[model samples]
Target: MKSRYIIASITGVSLSLMGIVGAQAYSGENLAKHAKITMTEAQGIALKARPGTITDEELEKEKGGSGLRYSFDIKGTDKVVYEVGVDAQTGSVLENDKESSHPD
Candidate 1:
């Protein structure tokens, strides 16, 4: 019985580690694989919605596929940063919020 329990624990741990490793490999800079819109198009869409220059971006999808969006961090001409999420499927802005970027 003790051996059985140890085997089960080892199996569970291995599976969990595999899952994490797989996910890390899966998300490595291949945001365009599942996006219907091009990264430039998405950047344009986000700029039109919020009006800023994109400084950074990443495509994100929830583990279960309930959410998929492109996250763009933009810096306005006046030096304010904005975080925008544009839907990967529909090419629409899902959400936008300003972030504090203190300039010294």
Candidate 2:
């Protein structure tokens, strides 16, 4: 009985860990079908345009970049945050500007 309990506990923990990992890996997965460019590709493009560590990222439908864009907020080596938007369909850099003091 004790061994069975231990096995069940282990299984529960493993499932919980998998859920957390899956969540992180698929942040914008729902919007993926609408994007021609993959998230990994967008990340590379965003980094090149801003040259910083990505603090936050998401695939959102905004008023640019084929109406579907991958947005990234990167913290520069100089400690400033920049918002870079990449067109999901064309892989073009749509916006690369300093993040405003008041973010939307």
Candidate 3:
């Protein structure tokens, strides 16, 4: 009886640990499992926010001490390069600043 109890306890603990791991894996915070917005969606949002053509884009989990966002470098027809950030969760523009004459 004691051996059966011990085995049951171990199984319970293992199941609990597996649940925790699975929860973490599926959490919205983990981009690999939950992507609120795709790269194409992010690019579209950035282009709309900056009114420019996206020349470069990257998925940023944490940038400059900020939360998950998509960074985009855009060049308008006027030749001004702009830096833009789209929130990964809400697909909103977080930052849009002119990044010198050079592109990032």
Candidate 4:
């Protein structure tokens, strides 16, 4: 009986970890909406910043509250990667910090 319980616990932990990993993979409508901006606009903004290659984009929830924000990853001219954030509702650029990356 003890062995059976240990096996069940291990299975449960493994399943929980899998759930976390899946959640981190970026699959959802909110994220899709944010990433759906026109490629022209994205390239225009990206050109100004001169972040090398655009990698990925997603919609992120605000930290202190409920709204949404758009974030994109870009390989910089200096060879370092960086993230950019824009307000989803107002279309205003918010922050360029890496910590701005998050799920909605």
Best by TM-score: 2
Estimate, for each residue in 1-104, the C-alpha lDDT of model 4 and write its tens digit: 99999999999999999987866554233354554444345444644554577677666676622266656677677766677665555555565654344331
Q: How close is candidate 2 to the true structure, as a TM-score?
A: 0.81
Lowest lDDT sum, 10 consecutive residues, model 1, at 23-32
Candidate 3 segments exceeding 4 Å error:
1-32, 63-66, 100-104
lDDT of 3 by residue, 32-96 (tens): 33457877787788988888788777776765424778888898767888889888778878888
Error at 96, model 1, angstroms = 1.4
What TM-score does candidate 1 get on C-alpha atoms?
0.61
The lDDT values for all models are 0.76, 0.89, 0.76, 0.59
Model 2 clashing residue pairs (backbone): none
lDDT string for model 2 (3-103, tens) is 99999999999999998887655457788998999999999999998898998899888996599999888998888899999999999999998899625
Error of 2 at 74 (Å): 0.9
For model 2, the stretches where C-alpha displacement exceeds 4 angstroms are 24-26, 101-104
- TM for every model, in the order presented, reads 0.61, 0.81, 0.60, 0.48
Candidate 4: give the clashing pairs: none
Q: For residues 47-74, could you state the per-residue lDDT of candidate 1 as single tens digits?
A: 9878877877888885322277877888
Q: Compute the lDDT for candidate 3.
A: 0.76
CA displacement after TM-score superposition, residue 69 of candidate 1 (Å)? 0.8
